[model samples]
Target: MSLLSPALRRSPAAASTSVTAAGGADALPLRFAAVGRSFGTGPRARAVLRDIDLALAPGEVVALLGPSGCGKSTLLRGAAGLDTPTTGRVLIDDTPVRAYDERCAVAFQEPRLLPWRTLRANVALGLPAGTERRTGASRVQELLELVGLADQADLRPREVSGGMAQRTSLARALARRPGVLLLDEPFGALDALTRLKMQDLLLAVHRGSPTTVLLVTHDVDEALQLADRIVVLGRSGEDPAASVSQLVPVPGARPRDRGSVELAALRSRLLESLGVDAHRH
Candidate 1:
């Protein structure tokens, strides 16, 4: 039997109910053109990213993999419009991205839920301005249900487990019905078992919603399990800027067999790209 709910397991003929535009309608693609980011001014500037040229097809799931300080999160933040690139530009559907156009949502490692509000209220905060309370409440309930937190809708953030809180955070992000979802190490704070479950839940959610996903993760297995393509970033000797070192495709559909020989081989190659020897373990 499948672990997903019927709604999630059903193949998406259109986008999820949370879609920003028409439900199940086509989403816009994201593009990064020679992007770069640096902190501070000349002579003291620290470059984080450089010459990052990439594109994400509508509804495709892509993973950014790299060591700490390799600018994976910085790249994601640029796409989210939380940070601007110091060089080049980011575009969505061929339009220059100066700010989030109600088309992007972001989830971070920490839940960052407001302690004062109930779970439902926390989620409702994601709704656009001028939304009626009744409508917002309905959307909150729907998202809570989707993330398996409906029963805990009234609880405060302090009352929930870390994983549950993260789920609530995800629900809040999805509340916007964004076309692009940016995840930055969202499961890194959880235990191994909980992380595995979150990965599965993410897959189920994606299967139902069908949005463009840009996930920043350190786990090779997690990227292999969730991403259609894995982008690896690294820095060269004495250069602070991180650049794309490898961009490899993971050819398969969703619900891929984790133990399949093809994935195993691909995992081996990915590990090598990160300077790890698969045979050692």
Candidate 2:
């Protein structure tokens, strides 16, 4: 059961739409209209986000980038239905998210696996009850293998390395077959080498499954490596006035070479956006 087998690493072009209901033409996946969120009230009120209009077709990967207090994670949480917006709307296939649903899945900064569950079982947890046990098990195994963790299937999260545990979390997300995948800094805690490897693995998994992915991260390099479009957020005044700056598209192809001129230019541009001197380390 090699993790990176051809079966698990199939071409992205062959991916099927996962969360579409049994209906007409899949309804264009997801849409967000003037999405906004706020907190507090009057003089104490704060706007965490505003004017967020975006649409995600099936198979798209968008990144949210910004400083610490900006609303990247808040926006993602709104989309995931984990947090309610004080204003505006978040929609998946035209339906509003008020609670958990099978159409979307989230992977947080931590793997969040139950310590008592093995890697395989954690993934199987996403399956519907009454799913044929063997079928659910097979799907979990397939996803584990896809994320390069098949051999670690029987291990509990505590027994695995952090990177390996995160891969298990990713497998769990994929097992749900959600059309929309929300990732909040899924690789932010990994070591440099492991982060790079996880980046590649994520790209490969996205390719294989082609879900609509929204990733929130502070790491500009990670955004460049994985996002088709990067949205930057910034704080306007002090506590009560933060907002999203702009959405910039990362125009390129898959397996984008880090050293290529186009990628280097993108990296430089993103660094500039962050007000970091590109020439500085």
Candidate 3:
């Protein structure tokens, strides 16, 4: 029996040479080449993504937006090497990503922190294997300070507010010093006000340690505010599979006016692509 599934064996990427993930750069470009994913087999097979091609420049932040079940998170999982694409490939700075690639770190909708660990210990959990104790401690401290959790480092997950716990999660991911940060609705669980604050915190985090960021989100406004480009995933016409339906660039620099006329126009276009009437309440 072949090591690869039949679908992967048919992919050009399947033959790629394996390489170790590294801190080759502070930020690494990510590419998805003709990526597709499906589950099950035979008549039970279901396709979630198809022909999804996207590229992120080093230090660029891109947001994936789509209707529920459009495979936004699936695409992100592929990049992180948490799941393999049925076809095509995911490349990081020209090298194929290995399984459980250390070059990338992921934070999901839930903080997923260990309840018993203090915020500091949770962040320390992401340090690379063999990291020197002193250096790791310094890095953890730096990240806690970066995420505004320095004052609460002793608190366990249960003691902190949801937003604080989420910040701790972000800090942990950053501790790995990954070239790519994959966030799947990291702020989706927070209340509106907390979500807004977290967004700003993320921007600050990016500035302090710029890396390629791939964010999967449902909020059009959040995409406009955080992404350098917004890739709308949806099916076209009769095709029931989702792909990059719209790759819209978010113009202007960071700290954009949330109510900017330009952003509003882009938001409307994105919402309409997802089958929502931009004019509807």
> CA lDDT, every prediction?
0.82, 0.76, 0.85
Segments of candidate 1 deviating more than 4 angstroms: 1-26
lDDT of 1 at 35: 99
Quote the lDDT for 17 in model 3.
Answer: 34
TM-score of 1: 0.89
Residues 1-281 of candidate 2: C-alpha lDDT, one tens digit per residue = 11122331233223333334221112124566787787888987778787777666555677888878778888888888888877778878677876675677899989999999898888888775687978788788778879988888999999999999999889888776777889999999999999999999988887667677889998888888887678787665564545557677665566677777877887888888777898883
For model 3 the local lDDT of residue 96 reads: 90
Best-matching candidate per TM-score:
3
Q: Candidate 3 lDDT, tens digit per residue, 39-106? A: 99999899999999887766678899999999999999999999999999999978898899999999
As for lDDT, the candidate ahead, 1 or 3, is 3
Ranking by lDDT: 3, 1, 2
The better candidate by lDDT, 1 or 2, is 1
TM-score for predicted model 3 compared with the true structure: 0.90
> How accurate locally is residue 196 in candidate 3, as Cα lDDT from 0 to 100?
99
**Candidate 2 at residue 203, lDDT?**
83
